[model samples]
Target: MAATNNQDLESKIATEVGHADVYDEKAAISDFKADAIEAENAEHNMTVLQAVRAYPMASFWAFVMSCTIIMESYDVFLMGNFVALPAFRNKFGVPYPGHKDYIIETKWQQALQVSGQLGALIGVFLAGPLTSRIGYRWATLTGLMLLNIFIFSMYYAESLPVMFVSQLLEGVPWGIFIANAPAYCSEIVPIQLRAPCTQMLQMFWAIGSIIVNGVAYNYNSLDSDIAYKVPIALQWMFPTPLMVLIFLAPESPWWLTRKGRFEDAAKAVERLGRKSAVNSTETVSMMRRVIDMEKSVKKPNHLELFKGTDLRRTLIVCGVYAAQNLTGNLIANQAVYFFQQAGVDNELAFALGLITSALQMVFVMLSWILTTYYGRRDIYLWGSFANFVLLIALGIAGSTGTNNAASLAQASLGLIVSVLFTLGPAPASWVIIGETSAIRLRPLTTGMGRATYYIVEIPCIFLASYMLNPTGGNLGGKCGYVWGGTAFICLAVAWWGLPEMKDRSYREIDIMFKRKIPAREWKKTEIDVNDDE
Candidate 1:
């Protein structure tokens, strides 16, 4: 039955793509026969720089797929900014005793914010089954179409309940998108392009955030409610183009292979690699060998995520994501609230937020350049440490000093923190987790990690909101102390557990874990996957 399915797929793909020799060239094998494959075919893959010079279309499509994260970024920035808008507040909350502006009650605010995360948690668990069944391209398209409905709801919302439900529904697409997009992006590129391309998720996130902050800074102060609606309407711009482009994009090659569609997988590789049929055939063969080895060793199940070497990989992936939330980024999200608490005027606060997003954009670009030379572990280790020290400075400057200098210092530190966090943990966290999983378990492990991340993230979001709210905890900069301590712990974990996966292939990563190589030695130890195969 499987052989018949393979032949049917081969005929269809060859007819459509003109790659007719796919099946006749080599018989698919379940076992890893190292000697049968050439060293050049199995390893010695293109570097990030070389891949782009060779295949510009591959990079272009990668940038297109990363639009999923851009949508995720725009939504998060828009929601955080919405609470700071005068019109949104006036519509949702009671007016203050002496002031004209209104604010949501602390508890209701927290509930509204965390509801999206809860929805995301549900989406993360669902992504594995849906993406596996429908394939990556369709799953992403489905999520984007659903997200458009929810975005319009927020634009038209007149009451708190409607907006709350809208935010919750919005998060469903976000969870599914976040769960699957990174894996898809990583799979579509070569090993050299893998980390840099996946890191585009974070870069585009900062781009979306900058766009929202730029728009909100200009429109947030209008007397009418259209100020907020215009920004909410901007959400439409992202999905429309993404939907059109995604329709034209190919399904993940790795995903096609998983479903016993080898001919289709080869065509995808040919498209992505811009190579001849022979090279694409060899690439598909190599991936099939790795995937076969993985499934034969253990059943691909959710329970397996918590078993053996995978347990460690899963834990590290989850920890990296959780560390992203805990490292004072929660305060960055509450930029307007923090500025209001520090006695900065509303306009200046919005300007600072704009500048913060811009600086994050700069640092994310810097991260791309740095990753070319550095490993993921040391970058995370140093970035977290610097972030902790900055947090302490921000906390002291914010809590004790009441003058202009102190306020300026606090804001300065906040901007610097944003830059360092972007350079260190922000992009690296997503890249590390996306690269760490086996192809068969990529969706399940990445989803579980993100779900765990949101589990830790929900409380941090609420706490950051409460601490900065004038009617709530009002911790001001003092909230930094709590998160700073958390950053220190994350730093230690990175130093101890995270491995160097720079330029490493999925097959190499699998072999390293199987051999029980210590995390610190991953860089020094050479595992020739081609020779071992």
Candidate 2:
């Protein structure tokens, strides 16, 4: 479902100055197809409240699939938190250099972190092809089944090597979960609901993180293996119930349409929205029109992502994800430790970390308000600019001697950086990644896009370690300067690169990209292809 850069499409642009330009019909849509497109467009153009009222099930189903992301968040936090657990360290560690306390080796921490990411990378690359082959419903089921089994290994593992293997295996299903949740939401919901639904993924992620932080804190003092095991056991809360939900939830209509399962697609549409508000058959026809519009020589291959307008789309999508780490969000991840390094007491630092995690959830919900009123491009741009400013301020705060005044300033700025991050780049990234990705190449494009997190993450983790270590850069909050510098570069790239995808439907977006519309001019440039009956 790919084509080379559509020079023909560019030539077809009627030399118009603004969006009101009309194109002569090259082909006409029949009343049946026209009704379908128009009906869907009517829904697409609905207000957020109108859309939600119209399609309540859309939100429910999106939430059903997104629950796994919460689990992914909790699981990642649990692994990272293990190094601090008294029981976990005693069970998995050796004598420290100068104390009776046990310590998990630095090498093991790094190894486990890298290996989990590697497994996730493998699963991400596999998700596109696997979902393409099996369809979203079955692929999700398959992932759930694997997750249930994999948890066993994690729960029972007695050694670091065995636990490392468990984490490696566990990441695969989580990766698939990551790759699928947003795409499914994008497809099922109308354009009005799409951004909010996908952005909600981050809210769920923060919820999981907060839960695990609480769980780890409560359990860490335990002198038994249950400290870690209970947290790992909590993961079971997701897969089994979700398996039931997947069985009950309708399949993605987009995937159904692509498979040429038209009748089933119509039924799935019926299942996802109110029957009175939705015309299932007409909606199915809309999917057909879009699929036909995007179809090209043979079925879509992953290589198509690199050819034509898709290459630009892929780069923008990847940049949205990688920008998360580049913009000093990592500093947010280490908030408690950074606070301690800034001279805050451990109790206060941990309390601040809890507040930071909770605020992250609040900020994600705040993104819904921002996107509802503003464009995705603006949120990203302003978000990046804000982060750049904050990082520079943080660096300056850090430059002063590590006194209470400077430390408090650094800690305060860092917390703002974290919560504000969720409001801007973190959630906006999902919206852009969900909205801007080529729909036909969505699974593959999204998979590759999500993979960039791990790709950017590995090096960032290594560098953050060195930069923060007492014997290394010892840069403290000055680390913000390095990330802020990168944020500046990313902000520039995003400014010159990101397009406004506020509320455009897939068909409208496809047409604009086909005609090679200028990035900055997307809001001003509009075209209507008359599908005359």
Measured by lDDT, the strongest candidate is 2
User: Tens digits of per-residue lDDT for model 1 on 1-533?
Assistant: 99999999999977866543443334233223433254234344555566776556667788898888877778777778878878778878887676668888787778777877888898898887788788888888888899888887878888888888888888888898889878888888776676677788888888988998899899877968888888878888888788899889988888899888999998887777656323676677777767876875544678988888888888888888888888998776667667767777899989988988888888888887777568687788888899999999888888776788877777777778876788988888878988998788888888888898789989988888888887778777777788889888888878888999987777788888888899999999887645443
Candidate 2, residues 210-310, lDDT tens digits: the string is 98778766775688978888998988988899999898999899999988899999898888889888888778877888788888666767898899899
lDDT of 2: 0.81
Per-residue error for 516 in candidate 2, Å, reads 1.1
Which residue ranges in model 1 land beyond 4 Å of their true spot? 1-45, 98-100, 276-278, 297-299, 530-533
After superposing all C-alphas onto the true structure, candidate 2 shows an RMSD in angstroms of 8.9
Candidate 1, residue 163: lDDT: 83
Task: Write out the backbone clash pairs for model 2.
Answer: 1-300, 19-526
Return the top candidate by TM-score.
Answer: 1
